[model samples]
Target: MSLKYIDLFAGAGGLSEGFIRAGFEPIAHVEMNGDACDTLKTRTAFHYLNEKNQIEEYYNYLKGKITRNELWAKIPDNLINAVINTEISAETLPTIFEKIDSVLGKDKVDLVIGGPPCQAYSVAGRARDPKGMTEDPRNHLYKYYVEFLKRYKPKMFVFENVPGILSANNGGYLELIFEAVKEAGYELDKKVLNAKHFDVLQDRKRVIIIGWKKNLKLKYPHFEENEPQYEILKDLFSDLPKIKNGQGEWGAVDYAKETNNYLEKSGIRNGVCFTSQHIARPNNPNDLEIYKIAVNKWVQDNKRLNYAELPERLIKHNNTKSFTNRFQVVNHKGISHTVVAHICADGHYYIHPDIKQNRSITVREAARIQSFPDDYFFEKSRTTAFKQIGNAVPVLMAEGIANKIKEMIK
Candidate 1:
């Protein structure tokens, strides 16, 4: 039997997707964003359809070969039953818990996995609103997570967050988090892991807190010495079709005829591809020149050009030393810096490696680096899509953790 799990604060279902890939059945996904909720439903519907051996029907819909109604007609009933679009809080917690109980009575949930909004504990968020972060109600959102753990009493639970949590509120938040997990009767183990170590193409670090009943005596999974090597942007993205600045491609974009190991493992099979969401934003002339210089310096000159090194024509400010490395050039052959939610604001920190592109990385390329499979679609506007991708846990990194959890449980 597949282990059952529920995802809370499930933005675009990244963690849930990885867990599901590791053989866990998703009971439900709880998220507050309307676009993300729609994505959840669509993805869940696709999964249910796939489970019923009807993925071809869904794929046909994605390729525009069938009507939306026709696609839904093939989706299993369980699809609609699995996504809950609501905010979890003290006020709505009881009703939500009651419904979960009703739907899953006597069926024990094996795990509960989620990361509450991390803005209150994220470095960028703290930098942006030094005082507002501490005062933000989101700081205590984990209490709702704790409440679920207390009520569900799942065999195990996974709490993920930005590394800023380690020092948020002078580390008091971390202490309280551990205390809450302990009070709920679970032994907890935590470590800060870099996604690069798990074959994710970005140098993203996240703190994962795994908790389980004391009686189970489960040990956290150790990093495998033989795990896949760190991936570079070129390895993950070179197969994707290129889009120029301000270019957007709907429907299907063609993939290279040749398949690489990463592409194959990521579910991008060798065939005519129907990838979506590969939209690139138009860079202003000023930013475009900056991107060109950055990419040229990184690729041709073998250096990262700082603001001070730029020609006076491209220099916009007097204080060049402060934000020297503001325009980051991604080395195609090297792993990327962390992809963050701020990417939605401006792509200055994530310029595409190819100088000819003259723009920041596209939504699809960002998703690729984050280990989201080509088939996994991000619904809504470019802003929402980028935010969802940037904020997501690298799916493969989550998968590695999920696999270890499954092994211990089994």
Candidate 2:
């Protein structure tokens, strides 16, 4: 039988997707955003029907041929009901537990995976906040995670967060986390992991904490570095049709060129001829001009554009002293910088390396950089899609972790 697990604070199912690919069955996904919840359900439907060779039904939905309601009707009730949409808080814990209990129904939870939202623990977020996010209530959300571990008594768990988490609260919160987990009867180990090491194209990093039952004989899995088959611009982006600002659509877009060996080996250009969310965000005249300069600077000198060095006419912000190097072009020649949640607010930091396009990266490009497959759709508004993509753990990286986990558990 496949091992069962629960995902907490599941963002667009990135981590869960990895676990699922590694052969674990997801019993439940607990999240607060209703839109992300919809995405989780859609993906669940895809997995269930795809196993039954009904992927055409999903392709139909993505092609705009069928409504979401129609797609859900074909999926089983149990799979559709696994996603629980609500906040995990003190007031809501009881109800969440009751719902999980109903769904669990004698199934032993072999694992619990997920991390609380990282805003309070993010360095960028703290820099923008007045109190440095020390006063943010999210600092204590780990308490709720501990509550789940105690309740389920999973043999193992994976907790993920940003590097800032190690220093947040001067290490007070992490101390609390260790204490809480120990009190709940689990031994834990932690390390900083990079997605590039896991065959992901982006150089994203996260703090991964692994825990197991106190008496269990388990060790933190050793991960090895993996190299991708092609460059970011040449292989990852060449197949997608290019468009200018405010161009492209969420529906299907035909492949711009024939798939190469690198693309196939990377599992990026999967047999699908079309994908969704290739659309770019609309850009204002000033932003467009700046984007042109940013892309040109990269194409010529391979240097980042400084906000303070922009033409006088294109200048907008009064205080250029801070965030001077905000307009950064993605390093198309190699691994790109971290894909952060802030991209949803503005794409200035994520200017596409292609000068002809003359805009920020598209939703599909961002998703691809994060190692999400082309067919994995992010539901709801485009901005929200960006947010979900930005916040998610890279599926490629998570799969590597999951594979090791499967081996260890077995």
lDDT of 1 at 114: 96
Clash pairs detected, candidate 1: none
Q: What lDDT tens digits, residue by residue, belong to model 2 across residues 291-386?
A: 889888888888888899998999999989998988899988987899998899999999888888988899999998888888888899889999
Alpha carbon lDDT at 259, candidate 2: 87
Best by lDDT: 2
Error of 1 at 361 (Å): 1.4
lDDT by candidate, in order shown: 0.82, 0.90
Error of 1 at 403 (Å): 0.5
Q: Model 1 Cα displacement at 128 (Å)?
A: 2.0
Candidate number achieving the greatest TM-score relative to the actual structure: 2
lDDT of 1 by residue, 64-143 (tens): 78865666566555456567778998888987887677667678899999999899998778888958488989999888
